[model samples]
Target: MAEWALIFKTAIALFAIVNPIGVIPIFISATDGWPAKDRAHTANTVAITVFIVLTVSALLGESILEFFSISIPSFQVGGGILVMLIAISMMHGKQSTTRQTPEEAQETAERNVIAVVPLSIPLLAGPGAISSMIITAQQSGSFWGHISLALPIAVVCLAIWLALRLSMHIAQRLGTIGINVVTRLMGLILAAMAVEFIAHGISGLFPSLAS
Candidate 1:
């Protein structure tokens, strides 16, 4: 039961952070004028790319931290700050430069293949998302626990694909204001999660504070 609860929490956290609905406008614009088949293909490619990136992060992130002699607590704090910045940006209905800078966005515009570059890499599976998965992976502790993280990643990626596949209908139904409202709501949830991450990291770093 506890494991299931954790999985549910993981799903919610990933969904809030990824915020596929929030990215609908960007996806629509990027795939504009492409045939429906090509747009669908792009969405699938993005989903697969994100899933692979995040799953790898969840599996190998701890090792990478160890290689650098960085402790999980330190990573948690840093990742928390990054996530908080993204949350703040989402609240303002803007993409974080952390995810993709102006240059990257411009490059994405000029590029022919965007599914793997800006869309999948930074736009969706950005540093914040990667770090969050790493933190969660460390917390999971067991081999099975680490593997289970993939379930939520798959779910979030699926949501991303669906959102992109139906981008036009969603845009028509929700409009810009509606999308912004949802983004702000997701941002609020993400902010609370970020605080929790920071607090937990601090407690881990200073055991005395946990008492």
Candidate 2:
């Protein structure tokens, strides 16, 4: 039961951070003029990439940080800032510059395989998501917790694939206004999460300030 609860919380946090529904329009726009089959394939590719990226982050993020002599608290603070920026962008109904710049968008449109670029890297498995996973995994403290985290990550990626595969229908039904509303709600969630991360990191990094 505890493991399941942890998975549920991790899944919700990842889903909120990933915001697949919020990116439906962007996905549609990027795949514009592509055939239906290709779009579906692209969605699959993006989901797989997201799973790989996040799984790698969860498994090896700590080692990577240690290799660079970066502390967990430092990463938490930095990651929080990145997430907060993305959240602010979402609140404004704009894509975060950190996630995808205009140049990257143009390049993604020109590329034959967008699954590895804008769609997967900065779109679905962006820094915020990666950071969130690493921090969450660190908190796990047990082999089961770490192992359990993978399930939710895989499920969230699957959810992203489904949402993208049905982008056309979803877009039509939800419309622009609906999507924007969802974006703002997610932004609010992300903002609160970011603040929590920052505060926790600060307390850990500076024990004197914790009280």
Candidate 3:
């Protein structure tokens, strides 16, 4: 049915926005010293955090923005800057530097917060996702429209879970080179998304700019 197609489109849009593949390097960095037994736990924790943040944001971020008199254009500009910086870092093969600052000669690795930081915030529920969800919801005034958008959010989280769960297998098969390739490719995608956000902001800022 038409409704199913809408859901599929929403899922793809969310998938592009979430891009689990983009977060792999960050995940590896976070779990660098974690025991093998704990890797799954860490990934699950990260995935769960992402799910919670994104789901909440999807449901209420718009309300919060409206209540605060915040503009999506402002978020578009700020979020675009953040995503572009992260994308550039990923593209240059330095994801560790992209999100968290290094521990700096090992006083003690700040590994505990990795799941919540780069993994959960920008990686999953960052500005791009939050903005996209708000826009999608507004566009989705009807019941089916809401369902369409919600399906994608759920699917994106599911993809994250699967990716993190299979991280070991993925790393083994891909090797560093493969992971690098995937990282850069995802970076390119992220870069494009960032451009869209910036454009959205700028367009809003100057109605006649791009026109």
Candidate 4:
């Protein structure tokens, strides 16, 4: 792997998936009722999930996609479509995403494990992130390449964890409106990222379109 290329790709993948800016509101909603101890645990859970998901993708995603005969470009196009749907939902407050679901509030009300399930799983590491990592892993065809990409992936997750830990302090100052503002801003970024993914996949499919 080209060291810089792996770092950049990993960074981009982590940004598009984790979306720390987008997570602000969800973090607020989920941990609103919890004590400090519980909130700390939730943040830790989110970070752990990120690492686990990426590690799995690094080890197994390529084989899984190969078993289905799915090409990386096709997967990227499909993943882009899925991510666009997620971005649209966030912008307008749609229910399919945990970040938007009424069920999320209810779950927060009923349980203490909010971050583990909805927040970390679907909201943070949902279909978009999973597919993105899988496609990336498939593209990383060599052991050295995958290994090189892994550290930056870990660093990104660390940043996300730290960001979530600080959301409480920021939330105190800006409140829900601030969270909403961040989410919307990140939504715009996500939409742009999705478009770029589609464009890359399309370019791969129709190379002569540029000619």
Evaluated with lDDT, which candidate comes out highest? 1
In TM-score terms, candidate 1 sits at: 0.97
lDDT per residue for candidate 3 within 34-81, as digits (tens), equals: 887787777778778877776666667667888999887776677677
Clash statistics: count for each candidate:
0, 0, 0, 0
Q: Which ten residues in a row have the lowest lDDT in candidate 3?
A: 99-108
Give Cα-based local distance difference scores for all models.
0.93, 0.88, 0.69, 0.71
Please give each candidate's TM-score: 0.97, 0.94, 0.72, 0.79
The residue-by-residue lDDT of candidate 1 on 157-196, one tens digit each, is 9999999999999999999999999999999999998998
Q: What's the alpha carbon RMSD for model 2?
A: 1.5
Clashing pairs in model 4?
A: none
Between candidates 1 and 4, name the one with more favorable TM-score.
Answer: 1
Q: Candidate 1, which ten residues in sequence have the lowest lDDT sum?
A: 104-113
TM-score ranking, high to low? 1, 2, 4, 3
Position 43, candidate 1: lDDT: 96
Candidates ranked by lDDT, best first? 1, 2, 4, 3
Better of 2 and 4 by TM-score: 2
Q: List the residue pairs that clash in candidate 3.
A: none
lDDT of 4 by residue, 85-138 (tens): 777775764433533466655665576567767777766776777776766665
